[model samples]
Target: MVVASRMLFRFSIVWFVAVVSCFSQDSSQTYEVYVSKNLIGTLIEAKIISKDVNSSKKILYHAFKEIERIDSLLAWQIPTSEISKINSYAGKSPVKISYETYSILERSLTYSESSNGIFDVTIGPLTQLWGFNGDEEPTTVPDKKAIDSCLKLVGYKDLILNSNDTSAFLRRAGMSIDLGGIGKGYAIDRASDVLKRNGLTSFLFNAGGDVLVSGYKAEDQNWTVGIKDPRKEDKLLGSVELTDKSIATSGDYERYFEVDGKRYHHIIDPFTGYPASNSVSVSVIAESAERADALATTVFITQGITGWQGTSDEEFLIVTNDLKNIFSPGFKKKYHFKSIK
Candidate 1:
């Protein structure tokens, strides 16, 4: 009777431990990472859902590290970054780079081609001249001679890429490339890849206003993303829902300064050497954050109402400076915009 009672006590303890483990597995985990301070620079926060506690932590940790790595590698401010090296060698010889950097640069060149230079990567000189690149601030608008000189260096065609993704070269000196418009989205996409490889079943990765959601938040519910009003800094224009997709928003309100009552934001028109004026804000949704990010910037610069009508592959919402919204067809079909007004 004593032996049988002892066996029953051990069995109850085992069952209790199993129950506690199950409860822990069903819970959620969250992490926050701060990388920089621009509208392009942002703090990232993510919520990961998984059953394995060890794997969840590992995935989240690695994802944040991946973003930091990308930031350092792509930042033009960092003198030792691969991009900085490339810019340093402009008008000279080809600068060899890692396959990762080569891949992104190659993709950027393609976008620069397709967008007809609206999304030129070689606009760094223009950005710097306007005091928008890195941490520089100018008290007034740049001179016409300076703007014209930078425009000479702002052509995407000047950036030459190699076939093997090993190296790239700039056609002339004084030309530089800026990846701030697309780097955040590329980093977010890579972070998502890390999470998937670590076996996360569900997640929401947000870097400031740029966000990517994987799987459902609940059994059947989607993730809700808030859209800020273009005119009002503290108000929300509406909200959109997403699942297994990414959304990237670029707005004039996110970064800029007023010069004699005229606002100058970061999204510069390569042709005019000035901040784009057609769209006050542009939010894009696509299968990947990289695409969404690139399109969001491209649309703002392109200044078209339909937003690249050649491609129905993604959805977009472009808000003009007057607060008028022009949405892509997919938005009307797939989303129900909730107005906060």
Candidate 2:
């Protein structure tokens, strides 16, 4: 169920200080340990505050280990990954997979169906067609005819899940699923579990921009995240305080190219086979990073704030194309948003 409300409020924004700066100041009782590495195509960073530095490093080691395991299992570009294997066996037979991969795929399909296929996992063909799936930047826009053909192979319904045997299959020969939209969030959740299991209560695990935080930054200060202005580089719209929750943001500025004065972004509309144009950016705060990540993409494609149906726990913030800020009712109530002018 959608956990946040659909009601939204707009305001002329103002900015505040970046909250992350305070984390660097040393605390007298606890040692703050920070670690970062390149993983899952982006930087994964973590901050652990503990009484012992050795224990903090140990906890981070286990956390990173869990994340690396998830990347190996879900990364589509890795030939040995279960996702790649599923794509390889498309239209032929079901490939048995790990419970973790199967469960994540099942959850991904749920978002796809709930979002009316606007957040499809079977968007691999379209991603590759626009050259957004690879290392090199796309220099030109793809042909409309080519896009139309690729769209035929892009449908979440075509991804068949056999829960009984823990296997998955793509019904069409060319249909493939890319977990890129949701995998990192799932990984962060897994890593968070590792931290908790190690008896670490205060830590923040961030995979790229998807963040899951628990406990407080200091004694009572909640961890704060800056919301980036989608149109302005190096400028933040505001900051929001969070604890024991996850937040993810999706934006056209993340990956895009301009051609003939038109900007083509990575977030594609499955129905139209082009960049979704409803909103410039969408940020979702949910109980799990997985849900926040998928909902961010779903809401971005489904007309931004207007497309969102709220649940008690999930809240969202959207920046319209005109650069106006829209906040979910729960978001406004739950988080103290310090906006920048």
Candidate 3:
């Protein structure tokens, strides 16, 4: 009887441990990662749906490599990239680009044209002149003379693309292309693709606040992602449940310069040559992180009911400068947002 009783006690303890482990697995398991690059800073947290803690390290390494590739391609200061090559072709014939660079630049131009110039990639010179390209201090706004000179060089129409050759070129020498607004989110999408292809059953990857989610939690559990409150970093304005989707946020809060008590953010209006003023922030939800990344900036720069009317097939959820949130009709049903006080 003593032996039998001891056996029963051990069985009970085993069952208890099993139950506790199950509960812990269901809650969420997130791994922290720090990657140093771009002077722009990249922070990401990945939550994979599994109890095996060892897999987290592998995922972190994979993500780090993916982000590094993006940084190299999109970093404006990096003088030996496809972006720089395109910039060099300015004021000359269209410079042929690699297949990869041409694809991204082509998509950028499409978004620019589709949004009616709200998402211009050719605004680099103006962005730099305004000191948004990591400049330490604000210079006076570029005068009408400077802007008009640059405007001649600006214009998506002037961006020459050869579909047959898969190359891109700018019409003027002073013209430059900066992918700052959209590159990270595109990188997040690419990284997520790598994870999924590698058999990562479920994962969430966020570059800064641009987020992409794939698969589900353990055994069919959905993933929940919180949209950061633009006004308060510590607060989450809302939570969205996703099985496969991407979320990207663009806001005046992301990066900016201040002069004369006015804040000039990184999202510049291609038409006005100034930081867009309509919305303080805009968050977009789409089927792919790439589209979400580009549209968030496009929506912010456009800033209105029609900010992204014809940009892409992807849907969106946008928050205005006044804190009033807008959602594409289809996207409205997907999540719950905390009410603003």
Candidate 4:
């Protein structure tokens, strides 16, 4: 209860301040999707290129349903979820998972290894320990002792995967996996694939600004994406041209609280068990939404811009805690900033 109160308090402040800014040309047809019980919302716009409104709407409904199903299967806390079942077997034995679950976990482990454990999916305990698993402010900061205890529950190396058996096991009792970092982006990419398979092109799939663009807009203009200004919610820092790619932005300003003039945000460092400091936001544009989203969080947790080294070859933008900006080599070549002066 104490932890819940803190999370609620912090999120109340964040939502109170969040301002979503978007701009589009006049020729697009707008469609609103309200999937029952899904936490994320999406806005899809396509030109009137398709004459069949009924068919288009049907395609969208199925697409949304597919996303919801993926979320349900992967959610760790949901009692009936596949992940919950795997968690139920944490220390006893390797629990066999669905093919999809196995695939995502395999990919997550690969990413964790690639990032040198910087992008661990097994940081669930630390995430919830700091009052970030849900929406709220913590009643109090956890004691270093308690936090250290939870930190023991982390470590991607402890997760054992059996390829032949298609099973997963966490060596420790309390260790668990959380896909919050990459699940949404994976779902977006999957939905985009589904749409393409259904013969629908030229659509945008976005979940709270983690977006994927598969085809060109109706008028043949590139998909225009606006990056939110981390310092000012009502303003945009820049816009990027997306011919065929995905974009994901992670920022501290979207979820944070200030106490005694010190700020605490939602992005947690696996090594530190606290909100990562220095970088305020990181936006990644990549060939896959999953990679973009994972890298966004990974880059934000890395201090002193050293993390930029791993992404030097990719297209990305970094907004520092003090508002200093760093763009990847390709980002400046493809986009323009609205506010940098």
Measured against the true structure, the TM-scores of the candidates, in listed sequence, are 0.87, 0.90, 0.81, 0.84
Best by lDDT: 2
lDDT of 1 by residue, 117-206 (tens): 777889999988888655656567789999999999888888988867588898899999899878888888899899888777578888
In the range 1-341, model 2's lDDT, one tens digit per residue, is 23333222111121122344455454467877899999878899999888889878987898899998998999889999999999999999999999989999998888877777888999999998998878899989899999999999999988999989999999989888888899999999999999998899888988989999998889989999888899888899888999999999999997899988888999989999999998899999999999999999989988665557446889999898888888888787698888976
- Candidate 4, residue 71: the lDDT equals 82
Ranking by lDDT: 2, 1, 4, 3
Worst 10 residues of 3 by lDDT: 31-40
Compute the lDDT for candidate 4: 0.76
For model 2, give the 10-residue run with minimal summed lDDT: 7-16
RMSD of 2: 14.0
Best by TM-score: 2
> Please, what are the lDDT tens digits per residue for candidate 4 over residues 1-341?
99999999999877665532134233345433323233533343323224456677677777777787888888886777777777777777888888898899988998888778888999888877877667566646678997898888899999888889888898888887888899889888887777788897777777777888866765657767888888886888878778668889988886677878887888888888878886888998888889898888888888524654344445778888778788877787765434532
lDDT of 3 by residue, 256-313 (tens): 7677988777777878777888888777877777778778888877764576753344
Question: Could you arrange the candidates by TM-score from highest to lowest?
Answer: 2, 1, 4, 3
Clashing pairs in 3: 90-172, 90-173, 91-171, 91-172, 91-173, 280-321
Better of 1 and 4 by TM-score: 1
Candidate 1 clashes between residue pairs 3 or more apart in a chain or in different chains: none
